[model samples]
Target: MRDGIPRFVPEDNYGKSFGYQWNLHRLTQLDSYVGLPVSRDRLLRESGWTTDELEGREVLECGSGAGRFTEVLCQTGAAVTSFDISNAVEANATSNGRFAGLRLLQASIYDLPLMDESFDYLVCLGVIQHTPDVERAFKTIFRYLRPGGKFCIDVYAAIVAYPHLRQLLRPVTKRIPPGKLYGVVQSITPRLLPVSTRLSAVPWVGDYLTRLVPVANHRHLGLSDTETVRTWSVLDTFDWLSPQFERPQPRRRLERWCRDLRLSEFEIERIRGLYVVRGTK
Candidate 1:
């Protein structure tokens, strides 16, 4: 183990963008850092698993960027084994290394080192769509879940047929180095935020107008202030443009995967912009 964490993947990979961004914005999405239960609420809502139910259970967390959900899972008293295909594992360790129940690793979903049918529960959030092969990644991780184990995951929803402004610019933005891409997003967010913020209030067309710009503004989401909104905007916008892959799955597709896998009591629904699929093995 290197730096007190197991390393299963190379230091550089397709997830380099995530490693870069999450390390820079290490605590940006943490519930504790934000003084809000944003991560906690989402974890509970999407997984439909309470802390009491998960206490002392084994949970395998994939794509644990900066340990936002790791903190929440560890607090549940679960034996949480979390991994990512990037150096974001370092950031996760920095943020949540103190948690006794947490075990951090740098590993790929397709090649996890753990045994099959080992975990009591599994959760992969804000990650599937970013993988090179979403379906195969899901199947690979699902193999490790024990029978009757609960699993939860979320992917970008393929709801819109037309490309948004972010999609239109991804060809150029994604090619730019992450550092340069972050700089560009940071520079543009301040100028366009007011315009997007203003348009977001214009009733029907307001949301559409805001989408035309590439920057992400979260004023309507009720952040503390404009600066917080800007910070989130820059971070999210970079996230949108810097990923090596950004695939969105349709609701039916998610349903088919669940059915094909024979996952019982599965529910596939759009929650807060992601297609959340949860079920039992």
Candidate 2:
């Protein structure tokens, strides 16, 4: 075990694209750069959690890529056990490792080497849809929650209109090596993002028009500045294209998964096209 966290090595990185991408923009989603703590607010708002509740609590953060959310969790005074399936854990550790109540682990969600019922709360965001099996990933983390403890998660929603272009293009893009694909996106994103920004401004059909293109649309998320939107655009576009598995879950399917896990107090919020679900064990 390293740093008091068990180790489970993966046969190969199923999410190596994420590993490379997060390390590239490790601090983009972080609040420090924007002075807003957007990730923190999203977590608390979606989870219905308060600083008072997080303080002194034991929290497990799954798929904590590059520690963007881990920084927020640390600020809550919660004892955070953060893990990722990539060397992005190195980036997270470099930035937040010195915090008093944080533990780091590098393991896969399919088989985590942690004790059951070991945490007071669990927070997983922006990760489930990327996993090979969303249900199995959900259950694996749910088993780590203490009875009556809350779990917060978010996944890509199955928007029939959204991702239409991504789906069509992924068959070709997924096969390209991660680095080569990133170079391709880097060349195209600058030109396409501005167009998406303007197209998204149109009324009625603007949303659909923007969705027709694969460039990441942070416009709907209220990010307007040229540089900020561009950064998010590059990061998100790479994120959408590079993953080995991409599954957008339907609302009913998510609810059924919660029921299958015997979780209670289940609440779901549709925030900016992402399905955020919170429930209790």
Candidate 3:
């Protein structure tokens, strides 16, 4: 298999950009402030993912972005194999150096190189939607999990009432990739709040204007790598500008596909803008 995406050492790139770190730092700050909307820590707490739940189990974390979930899974005592398609792996490797039992690898979701049925628990979060083929990716994940083992994941939701509203913003952000614009907006939008309080009073036009202008200072989680955050954002914007397609399949449609794979669908939840479902494979 190919080596994972090389670590994005922005020291090699950031010198030329303006206000880059501001945008990046602010996004990292946002991460610490809120729980990952994919059921949040509440789901992790309920799933018994605390220390004893993953004890001695073989866990595979697909799309272990920046190692946030990896750190959580690590607390559970499971041996985790962290994987992703981008430089996040290298960032994870660098960020996760102090931790052991972590095997970081980078590769495509549809074509994972590991052997079949290799893990007792497969934790693939925030990844299925970004894949070119969500069905095949699900099938690939199913292959990695042991029989009766669980695979938990959160997918982008199309069924939510505001997607059309969000989708309509595409024209304004048409320069942004439909896939990644949300990531950009989540980070950049919050910083615009000073004027946002004033601007929000306007109609739909207000939000658009707020989004177009870059804020002077952003926030950070302090635990995060400031450089990686900037790189992730710019790349996310680039990714949205050029993507696999416009949007991904809805949650129910993905659920049906999971059914087709003979995977048992056990939990499904509709959060603010995402539909999260986890199952046993």
**Highest-TM-score candidate:** 1
Ranking of candidates on TM-score, top first: 1, 2, 3
- Candidate 3: stretches off by over 4 Å: 1-48, 161-191, 194-248
lDDT per residue for candidate 2 within 11-76, as digits (tens), equals: 258877887888888778878766666777788888888988899999999998988889989988
Clashing pairs for model 2 are none
Where model 1 places Cα greater than 4 Å from the true spot, the runs are none
The lDDT of each candidate is 0.89, 0.84, 0.56
- Candidate 3 residue lDDT tens string, 1-281: 32433332233221111113222333332233333322236347334355576788899988765666776676567798877765455445555645677777766666677889989888776567666667777677778888888767766677542333334554456454333554665566445434544554568776445344443212222224445444444444433333333445576787687777777556667764466667677
Q: Name the candidate, 1 or 2, with the larger lDDT value.
A: 1
**TM-score per model over all chains:** 0.96, 0.94, 0.65
Locate the minimum summed-lDDT window of 10 residues in model 3.
13-22
lDDT of 3 at 74: 69
What TM-score number comes out for model 3?
0.65
Models sorted by lDDT, best on top: 1, 2, 3
- In terms of TM-score, how similar is model 2 to the real structure? 0.94
- Could you tell me the lDDT of residue 175 within candidate 3? 51
